[model samples]
Target: MTDATRVSPFLGLPGAVEGEGPNAGAPAHYGALVAEQRPLERGGAVVDLGNLGVIRLRGADRLTWLDSLTSGLVRSLAPGESGETLLLDVQGRIEHAAAVLDDGESTWLVTEGTRADEFASWLDRMRFLLDVRVERADEIVAAVGVFGDRELGAAAPNGVPLVWHDEWASTRVGGVSYATTDAHPGRDWDLHVHLLERPALEALAERVRVGDVSAAGIDALEALRIAAWRPRLARDVDSRAIPHELDWTRSAVHLEKGCYRGQETVAKVHNLGRPPRRLVHLDLDGSLGALPAAGAVLHVAGDPDRAVVGQITSIGVHHENGPIALALVKRRLDPEAVLAADLDGEGITAAQTAIVSPEAGHAADVPRLPRLGRRSG
Candidate 1:
């Protein structure tokens, strides 16, 4: 049973409205969703990500062990360096995602709150003869998200500020992008996560209350994230999701890394086949005054049969972009084809912007041999 009484201090702000689902235990908005979103985009406001989980790993084998288990190449991370990594099932389906930061002596993994316990337990079970110790630090640490490189008075337990800078703006070494667009939306994304001690979080909350620092909620943050085409493990992924479909290879995956749980599938898919589906950004028609909920079925516009071609994964009302969403559609769907999302009995038109290109995958460009049977004219 989940504890209903657990809540973040930021929820005490005036006009705060609690969030739901993955954002539970934190404020959804402070009465003005759009207004709150503007300040956040400009790096003037902070969003309380207290719902994120923190895990600490300390040992001489921590980095090497983690590199062997996750998708990112973290074995070479220097002190205070940040990286994004994904834990995949044996079949290459994403299981967990984390913002990784090292403080020389300890490696901190900040992941979705809902996955913390399960992630920690799995790590504990895998620690057979390693020098590593895994500790769930949710009770003592909290997370705050901000844009740009603004200083937030973060806690520095090991002489380095506990901040995990997101590298989604471009592909890193050993990484490849499935998004064919030269000007990817994520090029403008500059998100950062700060891990804070209990005392630091309390102090920051007081600053927010006194107007010394601005505060936004998950609603505001979600809007910016959707607009940037950033994929969150908790919201954008389904049971069959793999890194290739979401173009997560742009940041969260290292194709040239050493063997890991799902490396075989990752390599095979990239070298020989295309992802079954591709992610796209949807500019939803908002004249109906209602946004399509996540998981809403999407169909080709003007289709007489209304055959479903995709499903919405995340939606947000951006301050500038109005209604926008991310959805996964069939990779073979015509890129110029129009799409519509079904909300109850109404259909809302959506303009598609490719995130993962339909032509993605087949990275090795393997040649196809001529058909052996010869032609029948």
Candidate 2:
């Protein structure tokens, strides 16, 4: 991949080839990690989530202030509770994704490491009269994630103090979903992350070394994420992305939340029943022996010479699904349309069997729009 480098707490591990993508610059995976994915899915794997950033927020008005600023209902979050939130631009384009957790004394915001500084800067600028404190704890805290079903303490190792459990694997409580499958595959994903302090970081890595804990790399984690049709900010978003397109309404959004940045577009699109594009999961032909990477072009295979219509957002080699990818396709493209993904210069056939249906917004049918620039008091 790219020669760019990042620090890894588990740098001493074997087969750690600093990865690319969400866990970019971190160990991709250990040998044959994919073969052990089922055990991971069942709850016994710990991963060095160095690619994720940890931020600590503290202040009397922290919860309420954040509730007024984001798409999550964090104002009333109790101790040890976790939820997710999004910060969108005025046009309803997703700008920041945050995994929020509370520990009574502080609120923890877990997000991509690459964007933590930017997110912290934005948070600093928004604290006019609010009693809030925002600070990046990347130096003091490290992140570890687990895959499978188990108690938070058991699933998360090293006695990590903060955790944000997976909510996107299903239509989490309070979330309204747009998925059409009879049984959503992600209903069993069971992913979660734990935050540990610097001193304890090596302790956990030692556990993996001594065989007390099993470690998977970012590659293994990504396979499951892509197979579940999960979206990631580093891989899935372009500057123009809106929550509706990724079916983010299923989580990381509050349909009934009070006005915040981008509420207008969030409301308009969900009610009007339209999104410019839709998220689709593609089963790519594996005969080429090479999988398409993100940004690979998707074409309508039945059309003359295969016309370009979309581009892959995420790609992976899932243990069960084999070679698969996620793409943002033009919303109106027929569900049954034959598809192909250009892997490098080689064109590979693809089939669309899973998607966030085009008619997703049908459930929210707001008949009238408020006058321009008017908001209710």
Instruction: Give the top-scoring candidate (TM-score).
Output: 1
Per-residue lDDT of 42-117 in model 2, one digit per residue for the tens? 6687777888877788888999888888877788888777788998988889999999988777888988877888
lDDT of 1 at 236: 93
TM-score of every candidate relative to the true structure: 0.96, 0.90
lDDT (C-alpha) at residue 199 in model 1: 80
User: Alpha-carbon error at 145 in model 2, in Å?
Assistant: 0.9
lDDT of 1: 0.89
Clashing pairs in 1: none
lDDT of 2 at 58: 86
Model 2 alpha-carbon miss at residue 122, Å = 0.3
Q: Report the Cα lDDT for candidate 2.
A: 0.78
Lowest-lDDT window of 10 residues in candidate 2?
151-160
